[model samples]
Target chain A: MKISELSECSGVSIASIKFYQREELLPEPERTSPNQAQYDTQHVDRLRLIRALVDVGGLSVATVRTVLAAAESDIPMDWAMGVAQRAIPGSVELPATTTRGVSEIDTITETLGWKVSPDNPGRGMAARVIDSYVQLDHEEILSVLPEYSRAAMIVAAADLASVGLQPSRMRMSETVVVGTVLGDSLFAGLRRMAQEDEARRRYAQVQS
Target chain B: MKISELSECSGVSIASIKFYQREELLPEPERTSPNQAQYDTQHVDRLRLIRALVDVGGLSVATVRTVLAAAESDIPMDWAMGVAQRAIPGSVELPATTTRGVSEIDTITETLGWKVSPDNPGRGMAARVIDSYVQLDHEEILSVLPEYSRAAMIVAAADLASVGLQPSRMRMSETVVVGTVLGDSLFAGLRRMAQEDEARRRYAQVQS
Candidate 1:
């Protein structure tokens, strides 16, 4: 089909389609002409996933491409899970039910407490959370995870963008590090602290 | 204090302070000179709140301003609770206690279930989550909240995006409505249904 049709089908724009092609997110389809390229349903699906990753998932094109390659590798879930481990150490082994809610949160609080106090209250909370996990049904708990994941990414992206966070290398590094290290909450927390800290200064300067 | 001093205290840059001043997140400070403006501690606190709402709370600047104004107007906690009926109607008021434990989680789940669903599996799991919540003191629970809130905002924002996720929006709105009216698992069952649907899609997509 035409690139226009691809754009309409993918809900991405014609210009975006061209850009994705350039980014190699969309495979270069067999071309009938120098400018016109034939696209297919796979292109649509791949672009859709890319759209989900980049637009909804807020992954960078390069990152999205890497994830796509992994998905396409048709690698076993084990390998995929292995790759995921780097982002979350125990997540691959998380009871599918509890991966949605992992020890990471407790880990987060523990980490914070370690930083701020020897005994952080968050530390205990994480424990109860893990114990509770023993009883939750897998499918039931796993279901909420996508919502949690998507929400975190979406908000993080919006926050980053709102701040005009730049120097892609620095910003992207921050994104990866925060997402990996802080387990969601602190990732969200630090940014909020920074933004508020910044806003407070500005508000004071403006206000008498 | 001068703008520079305000910036120093607030930890925001001079430019952002000027911007917030222009945006009115801060009231106009006393101008001490042709090139200087003065701010106070009150200004500092208010600016801090503004940043908290916008950055931590994921509120837009306009929304942050409105929330602050409403806060000034003495919007009752009950009123806000009433409005929150959709997300969690039957749910009990957030526990006043900063510290919580498994028993508290059980109580909240039971109380919430009475109004929502008695056999709601999610409630059971939420109760389990108490174990996790219990690990930390109140601050830790709150620390997790910003992450949770950001996650919610991400989904809300994503729904607003996604071309015409009108259906997704409608579903969420209905969830709110169900939460408000049915105040039960009516909406939750719907959420479970969505997960089932997503699972089906995943299965089918993988096969195809």
Candidate 2:
């Protein structure tokens, strides 16, 4: 396929594809002639993955570049996943950096006996969420943390298992990178649908 | 309190606070005299909410403005929540307008008896996610939708319960708006932490 076909297939503009090439996000194509380049299935796959990460996953270009590098490398799946996960943006700041919040997350993780690295951004991200709830004087919302974590565990188990089932190393790598990013949105959307269902079930009786 | 004190307390820059005020994201502070405006605890609270929605929720200024308006309105909690949830961005694009994807989502929601409106962005968002996985030829990933929806129901049950526990109409409305927005990030962050834990547990013995 030519670059035009790749652009058409991926729904990415030709200029943007060229820009991704300039940014080293996409690999150089094979030159069939002095003025023509030929792309293959792999190029189309990579472009789609990049579009998912940038457009849907809302990852920054630099972050997308790092993720692409990880996807292409022959690194272990777990290692590649770690790199991709770390590149994700974390939460913004809050007033009074609360040691209490950190300690609370520590308690939950310890109680669950889940061996996560001390440096995982999820730790800080979760803590910041707690802080946000606290700042709003809505600390009662944190009571749902245990339930949320349990749901997370279930979803995570499925996610991890899906990555393991991929047929190829490249597929596995793509799943780890693109899957982890877009999975957030996927679950979020589903969660909202489920929430609406549950809300109507519980409240429809009372409201009527 | 003075604007400077509000800025210091909220950790928002004076200019940004002024910007929010102009944007009607924050209600105008009472003018003490021609040269000065006096802010109170309400200003601080609203500022923190604005920051949470903008910084953590990743909402646009325009979306945040609508959300703030919802928070101030005497509308029902569910109505306010609907506004906030609808304002959230969804997936970018997918190949071929698949009526199949829409019907698939409709089937799932119908089976669950979830009374989601036709216009809910979650409906399309969820469909687009499925489409992305299909485009990548990883439709197997969609197999977990049932599990994900189950988890979402549990979380949503807790979320609605929490809103019901709020002490005032204003607080409930605020939670409906702000919670619906930031809750996505809150859950995403927690899901990552939970995922790390689960992955380590499942794969640790294999690797180590």
Q: Which candidate number maximizes TM-score?
A: 2
* Candidate 2 Cα misplacement greater than 4 A, ranges: A1-75, A89-98, A205-208, B1-77, B87-98, B205-208
| Model 2 DockQ class | acceptable
Q: What share of the true interface contacts does each candidate keep?
A: 0.05, 0.53
lDDT per residue (tens digit) for residues A147-198 in model 1? 4334433443333332123232322322322322223322222222222223
Per-candidate Cα lDDT values, in order, are 0.40, 0.74
Q: What is the TM-score of chain A in candidate 2?
A: 0.82
Per-model B-chain TM-score: 0.40, 0.80
Model 2: how far residue A207 lies from native, Å: 7.8
Which candidate should be chosen as best, given DockQ against the real structure? 2
lDDT of 2 by residue, B86-174 (tens): 66564333335656567778888888888887776677777777777777677888777777887788778877888788876556656
Q: After superposition, how far is residue A89 of candidate 1 from its true place, in Å?
A: 19
Q: What is the lDDT of residue A168 in candidate 1?
A: 29
DockQ (C-alpha based) per candidate is: 0.04, 0.43
